[model samples]
Target: MSTDNSEHMRTIDRWLAGEVVNNTIGIKVVGGPFDGRTKIVLLGEDGRPPAVIRASGGPAGPSRHAYEAVRSTDVRAGWIYTYTGPEPATES
Candidate 1:
């Protein structure tokens, strides 16, 4: 799995299927209505990108200029959506 933490990586015995993990670039989208949408996860207080993405050209937000510019290139940058699911029950 893609993790954003600097902690030493280690193998574990077991884990819950839906257990929240580190946040990072989970998925990359290319085409369709939602283009350049990357899944940046947020597991508790963990996870953060090393640097911000700088677009060589085009305006910010959903714009034809940005979309076309990104579509023309082999690949570019766009938006990032944080991933979150129903929080597991916590002990009170």
Candidate 2:
């Protein structure tokens, strides 16, 4: 379990560091079934990191809403996806 956490942390670290790009990365639910609770993910460009974006209220349609809203202003400040799954168990 620690290994899984560590791997996820590393991936997030890379993503936060801007090492990843959008549209090239793909996400997968590795630990459990895609129950809509633990299957949300963020994809990035090839050879880059990926980030998972979440909102304050809850899950909503138009996954790209947040991405588009943020990207419209800055264009390169955050992840390119809106999360709609269970909260991450561990954060680094």
Indicate the TM-score of model 1. 0.19
Tens digits of per-residue lDDT for model 1 on 1-92? 55733232421111112122443333333343344454333333433332223222223333222112121233222223222222334466
lDDT of 2 at 51: 39
- Give candidates' CA RMSD values in order: 16.2, 12.6
Off by over 4 Å in 2: 21-92
**Estimated TM-score for each candidate:** 0.19, 0.28
> For model 2, where is the 10-residue window of minimal lDDT?
64-73
The sequence of per-residue lDDT tens digits that candidate 2 reaches over residues 2-76 is 999998877665544434433332232222123122222444344323434333333343222122211212223
Candidate that would win on TM-score: 2
lDDT of 2 at 11: 69
State the displacement of the C-alpha of residue 44, model 1, in Å, after optimal TM-score superposition.
Answer: 17
Clashing pairs in 2: 20-49, 21-45, 24-44, 24-45, 25-44, 37-86
| Cα shift from native, residue 39, model 2 (Å) | 16
